[model samples]
Target: MTTLSSATPRVSPWVLSAFWFGTAFHWLLLLLILMPHDVVRFVGEGQKGTYLGVLTAVGAVMALVLPPLIGARSDRSGRRLPYIRLGVGVNLVGLAVMALAASALAGMGGFWVYVLGFLLVQFGNNYATAPYSALIPQLVPPEQRGRYSGVMGLLQAVGQLLGAVTAFAVGLLKLPVLVSFALIALVLLVPALITLRGVREEGGAAVQAPRGPTLTWRQLFAYQPFLWVFVTRVLFALGQYSVQPFLQYYNADVLKQRDATTSTSIMLLCIIVGSIVSALIGGRISDRVGRKPVIYVAGTAMALAALLLLVAPSYPVALALAVFFGLGFGAFTSVDWALGSDAMPSASSYARDMGIWHVAFVAPQLSSAPQGALLDWGNAQGGNLGYTLVFGIAALFFLLGVILVRNVPEMVGRRPLTQPDGNL
Candidate 1:
């Protein structure tokens, strides 16, 4: 009988791929289902942005704090799956509350309950995400990270395409929105079940025991390569997220699209198409060329896409812009993880450090409300100059991120980072 080595654990790419597909389905729906339109209906029309932003902000606070702590715990226990299951359970409870609140039994009282439910989901989702992402570096050898990231991106695009298409179809059918939500929830559960039953984890190999001195938060901050990556990601996210939550409104008010749902879904499909193509190729390109070059191309394309969207007059033009945006975004998403994985200071603190890195992903929540308020204030002056202005600013943010990324002294795919004197 052969015993598994602590340093190397056999992890199935298929299982990991399945897990990402399910998680993408779960995550995208959780965010999308509570869009500005839903908030306007539930909370109030004029204050939709405010209410949506506030709820997300509150939820984000939990997301900000929970992931790293849970990740640290997972690191110590060397058990990622247990924490993953616990997060799923917590999210289900939140989803249940949300479903019930939206039901006839809850009535207007459901609004507050919905808020509570969403916050719970945010907590659980973030906690789960931290551990789940940490698995990539733990399982895959360094050389293969880009390929795996690409495949994961491919599945993510599929899940997103399915979610968007189904959302449009469900709206056309005039089924209860809650029913659609239930369907998305059910879809999310498939991966959870696969992970629990089919995915194998050797407890000792999941994470290693900390060696010598424990890494302090301040020390983590001092790691220059990672610090730059973290900052660049935050800026990129700010640009990306600022426009995402409000695209529906842009269609309805700016483009004068009567069928906002269909329009939104169509644009999403365009994005999916571009993302699928680029993600499939971009990861491998990064592997051959370098992560930074791919990211540079992605950032440049995104900024240009945003500028185009700002001036886009018709739905067709906007649809074209969405494809460009997706191309850039897909490339970024495909290679970004490989870059971060390379920057990890050590394996022992991967979860905790990655959890901190995850903050860049969610920290956009902090600014989302303010940006929404800016939109409202601009609209108050008449004309939808607000949308144009916000998107323009978002473009600048993307450009700034592109500039900042160059500061990180990193080499080509899977190449080691070292100082001038050959020190890491």
Candidate 2:
């Protein structure tokens, strides 16, 4: 039988920060690329949302199954590196395939190749993220998780800024789209490589053996607090995801802006700024008060932002709304993981639990495609009613998200794994 440490050793501050930076950079880079701008460019205006949504939905199906299974396997074996390394290899290959597909569609378009490429990217990245997030509980002591989460939020802000800047730079240089994407891959890979090399988990010396009866889906979801978190997340995520991919399209198609890229970039820039401020403060605040209150505040702020967008007359007004939304989202991002860490059903199944929790984000993608179809449907009816309706629904979801978490217990500023320690 293998022996494992009772307590997880805390990771050094600098190394953990660098790891966060690398992970954020990689994720933000992918998000920027997958935004509506690229999709509309290839698939055309009328169908871009639906096409992108469809592709995302299709890919999400694969992502839904893979992460949890992989995370569970890692839990059993007491290793994340091997899986993470495999993810990196898969991700690189997926990016290469995507670049090739994008190149082929330089003229009119080709759907299947691009779809396949995207699916592979989803599979690779989601595989990596499960293990990546699982590291948080291992690295940060529970008392300081809020602070660590804050730092992560700051890195995420920086990464968002970097991703937007890179996108603008690619456009300004007028590089071939495929080449631009390739450059992004290179940029993300640098820090990822560093993270892989530099950050090492403790307890590798003694591998963990699975303890107790096997975890089951039914038993896992039965944990009420986790269920509440998942429900709130899925609702808010649906609202947020439904709106994001449509922003650029709404600007160019409905608002009729020739400089759509610049406009979009400005809004994104504002979001980055807002996220930076909240991320720095929100996590620390949650530590003192509680995660639920912070999330409530964040959700309300986001709802207000959505309402403002629904009524805004011009791009400038929309820009202002973006800032508010960013602030809210930034705060939520900072505290959410800390809360998840607190609410985990089992320490042994951290990665697996996180993987299941990830479905809140993933399931929303499936709705996004249908939401796009809804947008197209609304436009067909005239008066841009579709956009208005969608924004309202988004706001409603945010509001409901705030309310749903009201009853869930808070776990801020408490030690993690109080129940028992596993080999991991």
TM-scores for the candidates? 0.92, 0.91
Which pairs in model 2 have colliding backbones? Answer: none
Q: What lDDT tens digits, residue by residue, belong to model 2 across residues 1-424?
A: 2223224433544445554565566555555444455677677777876776777678879878888888887777666666777776677777787778776766444556666777777787778777766767655656667777777788878877777677667666777867756765776567667666655544444334224333477766776767888899988898787787677777776566787775666677888888988986998998888888899999999999987887788888888888989999999988887877776766677778888888877888788778888888888789887888778889999999999989677766544333442211
RMSD of 2: 3.1
Which pairs of residues have clashing backbones in candidate 1? none
Per-residue lDDT of candidate 1, residues 250-351 (tens digit): 788788999777788788888878888899688888778778888899999999998888778788988988998899988998887777777766566567
lDDT of each: 0.75, 0.73
Per candidate, the number of residue pairs that clash is 0, 0
Top of the candidates by lDDT: 1
How does model 1 score by TM-score? 0.92
